[model samples]
Target: MMEVKSKGQQVSRREEILDKAARLFKQKGYVATTMREIAEQVGMEAASMYNHIRGKEELLEEICARVAETYVNQMNEIESSDLSPIHKLQALIRSHISITTKNIHWISVANNEWRHLPDSSLKSFKKARDTYEDRLAEIIRSGIDCQEVADVHVSITLYTILSSLRWIETWYKPNKSYNARDLEENIVNILMNGLKKSG
Candidate 1:
């Protein structure tokens, strides 16, 4: 029992460190952030921090991998669901907003700082990112096939939607005027239905 508790505490401390490191990476960038600064953010001495993590690069890699895997897993689920193409797109958009809102710092770090990852990890992360985008493009292609979505350039459509979704980390704030659900619904409506009013 005591051993299990010790392990749990270690895990908790590691996560705490990751959380602070993610925020700092987003703000100052992965190249600019140091392990000592991360330790300071987490209220630990710089030397003692080595006991919890190998170094700063490990933190960035962990964050980028975690965020990328989450997106890939969610896309896999949406792809396998029984919903029609349009509905699947809606679900995907909603999930994107929800996850971005909940993990904005980590997502921001993943988006901006992933390039700093070591060679092998960088290759893997790029592959994961590309795969996720390809999955989204496939869904849009299916929608176009069924005449459910406009027959615009598939690559252009994917980029537009993804770029918009990715920017949420830059500007979104949890304030009284809007919330995650509201943002999700609005994005889905505009992306799915367009701005033209129907008679």
Candidate 2:
């Protein structure tokens, strides 16, 4: 029992460290953040920090991988759903807003700092990102074929929607006049209006 409790505590502490590291990485780019700074933020000494995490690169790789996996999984589910192309796009937008709002720091770090990942991890991350975009583009293409979406360029449409969603991390604040749900609905309405085929 005591051994199990110790292991649980260690896991909790490691997660706490990762959270702090993510916020720091968001505030001060991954290249600018130091392990000692992360240690201080988590109220641990630099040496003790090493006991839980190997180094800054490890923390970064974990954070980036976790967020990327989440997006890829969500995309897979949305792509496989029986919803129409328009609805699939709406669902995808909602998923992005939901993930960004709930894990702002992690999302920000992943978006802004992923380029700093080591060679192999960087390659993997890019592949996942490209695959995600390709899947999204396919949805738009299907929508166009069905005449559910306007005949816009798939890459342009994909990036336009993505760029708007990605900017949420810059200005989004909780407890503001607008909430996540409200933001999601408004964005969906606006983007959908633009994409929906007109007479």
Residue 74 of model 1 has an lDDT of: 85
Model 1 segments beyond 4 Å from truth? 1-11, 195-199
Clashing pairs in 2: none
Q: For each candidate, what TM-score against the reference?
A: 0.90, 0.92
Clashes of 2: 0
lDDT of 2 by residue, 1-199 (tens): 1010113435688888889999999998889889989999999899998899899999999998888888988888888999999889988988888889888888899899988999999999999999999999999999999999999999999999999898788789988999988988899889999999999
Cα miss at 20, model 1 (Å)? Answer: 0.2
Q: Quick one: best lDDT, which candidate?
A: 2
Model 1 quality (TM-score):
0.90
Count of steric clashes across candidates, in order? 0, 0
Cα lDDT, all candidates: 0.83, 0.88
Which residues of candidate 2, in runs, are more than 4 Å off?
Answer: 1-11
